[model samples]
Target: MKIAIFGPSRRVGVVVDNDVVDINGAYAKYVADTTDTARSTAAAALEVPADLNSFIEQGAGALAGAKAALAHLSANSITTGLDGERLVFALDSVRLHAPIDGKSRVFAALANFADHMQAAADNTASGSDKATLSRLVSGGPKYFIKDPRVVSADGDDLQFPRRTDLLDYEAEVAVVLGKRGKDIAADDFGSYIYGYTLVNDWSIRDNVSFGPDFQYSKNFDGSATVGPWIVVDEGLDPQDIDVEARVNGEVRQSGNTKSMIHSFAALGEYLSRDSTLFPGDLISGGTPKGTAVDSSIRDSEGGFEDDSAFLNPGDVVEISSRAIGSVTNTVTGTRTGKK
Candidate 1:
């Protein structure tokens, strides 16, 4: 089942066919009708919460309740709830929010795909002995934590940073953890997996931060663009998702997670060793080859020395997959970063 937070109020919803069922409203009504009237509100909040993060934290009980709520709605033709809360809504009538609110940390894999690293190096490296993704991966998995403050949702306008002219995009699959686990064993990812969302790792190529971490280069107002919703990991093979990145209508990056240098289990084990991994904590698999700064595209189209062209003010960057769904966002706000 697909789970989402929708509309201006940010209520938790379940995607069924072409409509979104308000989970809280449906579950509350179920509680009131099935058990006791006094237990309705509290029961719905605890069993199938209004926040996606809270819902995940509730674990299997919440999952069962959410499914039961959907079943309850399907059994009847309910339109509105006891307090005039909407039971079901047209999908297009509401706005999609990030699967999790801005409370969870987003950990992203860096240089996990050899082709992506090759593209970055091919554009800038001039030395005879240049660094490669393979060389960078002789040790282990590398990752960077995104600033949760800048977590933008699908269809939201990207806040173009006012500091750099070279804006780039990295398309990836972000995994949402199901439960809290510290020092997760590499082979034990079967139970910890929860769901997946698409992420576009927007970067300002010119902004330099100390060391390899893109601390300053990545922490803009809209760098971590995620969601339409999260697809539960029931049928997906996390290590084998096919992802594609496009600018407007043109393909910029295309690769499968099978190309990843480090396995998902290994990355999970490493990430959890230092700190506890919780439900709703997003771990983004690294992007594939072909960013805006790709050398081949730059050489083919002679608009700039670095690449074809940096992200303009009105370009649409779309990151999509067959299983997880798509995230489409327009480059909006100021172009002061280009100035």
Candidate 2:
């Protein structure tokens, strides 16, 4: 089942075709219409959390309850109306937020795709160190922590940081953890995963080459654009899904998850070797080979010049996949100053 946080209140909703079933709202209605003793029983049987983060943290029991509630609603003919605005609202009517806002530790893989690594290699100067590239090619997935505050929802505007001229977009697939585990093994990866979501790992290219730290280049406010909704991992295969990205309706990045240098299980094992991965922690699989910086608009010094390839203030970036839906964000004017 696809789950989402919708509307101004950010309530938990289940995406059903072209509409969303208000799972939390339905449970609340059940409690309101039942007797004192029956209300307690109903609440326990249909325990849908108020938000997506809390829902995920509740583990398997919460998911089961939510599915039960959805089944109950469907059986009773309580689905949305013809206009898709009754108990279930039209998918476009309500606002959608990042599935795990302020509730997840965001970690993203760097150059996990062989083609992306080749692109980065081609763009770098001959005098540059190849040690990091060599390590990524042979070693496990290279990752960096991103601030959750940078996460923005679908349809939200991405703020162009004034500090940099080369803003780029990376379309990636994000793994959402359901259970907590330390030193998790590769074979047991499925037991710990909850679902998958779309992630636009926005980057500032200027800050990247100057130093080794990725936080400065990637963690600016509204840098991580995530979610139309999260598709549960029950029947979905993250290893072989199609991933694509478009800027202002023009196709920019086109690739598949099968091209990943490191598998999802390998990334999970590497991440959990010495630390615990809790529910709601997001692990973004690296993007494919078609970023704006990979275009042929580079300057003579191999840096991106102010050109058509780099993201501008009015550009609209839409990142999509076959499993998880699209996450579209428009670029807005930047605030001038260090953020």
Candidate 3:
């Protein structure tokens, strides 16, 4: 089930045959029709809410119920809920939102990719410190918290910030947690994962000089571009996925999840050490190299001087994975006209 939370109403939906199914409404209708209860609609909403985050909180039963509801819709040709609520829609007919919004926390790993870490080491480290990035994973995955307020959805416009001229895009695979757990073992990560999604970890290249902190470079209110829909966890390997990024349709970054110095299991275990992992909380597992700054030093064809290297007004930045899906956000004009 590729589940999504979409549009102005923020309804939870399931993608089937390239169309969006209002799973919550369908589930409500299913519950109302199957059982003898006048308040079945209200009951269904409580049992299996229409919002993705709330729905996720219901855990496996709601997941199973929603799947059965979708199956019921298909089996019976159901088009609308009991109160005439829309139960199905064309994929492009409505807006797509980040699966979890305001309902969860986002912790993003830094330099999870060996190639990316190597690139960073090559640029900044000297002597024995250069290119020896194995120690990163040896110490386990490290992350930084991203302000959830900055999360923008697929097809949304990312407003270019006026503070820096070096806006960049990073393509990453984000793990969406399902069950809350503390000090979970690496082997149990599969049970706790709900699904996977894509995230463009937007950055301000020039702002790093002021950082030991990332707030100035990474959390500019529109930096977290996430989702098309979450590809539900159904026993798939999170450590073996593809990652790609394109700017204005030109492929700029490409790597696989297998290249991660730290695997999903390791990262999940690291995150749950003392804190609770909750449903809808995202673990943005860092990005692969070929970011603008990486290319500013590594690209063989002198790609650094290219105006298309960094985001500018009207550039569409797309982050993708074959297993999860893709998300594209167009970079629009400044938040203010300061620049």
TM-score per candidate, in order?
Answer: 0.91, 0.88, 0.89
**Which candidate, 1 or 2, would have the higher TM-score against the true structure?**
1
Q: TM-score ranking from best to worst?
A: 1, 3, 2
lDDT of 3 by residue, 119-238 (tens): 755644334333334455456677787788668999888888888777899999988888778999999888888888888889886636323675668888778888988888456678
Per-residue alpha-carbon lDDT of candidate 1 for residues 22-56, written as tens digits (9 for 90 to 100):
88888898888778568798879888888888888
Q: After superposition, how far is residue 231 of candidate 2 from its true place, in Å?
A: 0.4
**Candidate 2: which stretches are off by over 4 Å?**
28-37, 40-46, 79-87, 129-132, 210-212, 297-300, 334-339
**Model 3 TM-score, all chains together:** 0.89
Task: State the lDDT at 235 in candidate 3.
Answer: 68
Task: Give lDDT tens digits, candidate 2, residues 183-297.
Answer: 9999999788899998999998774653476578888888888898889845888788788999989998988878888878888999999999988889998999889766534
TM-score of 1: 0.91
Weakest ten-residue segment in model 3 by summed lDDT: 298-307
Pairwise lDDT winner, candidates 1 and 3 = 1
Give the Cα lDDT of each candidate.
Answer: 0.80, 0.78, 0.80
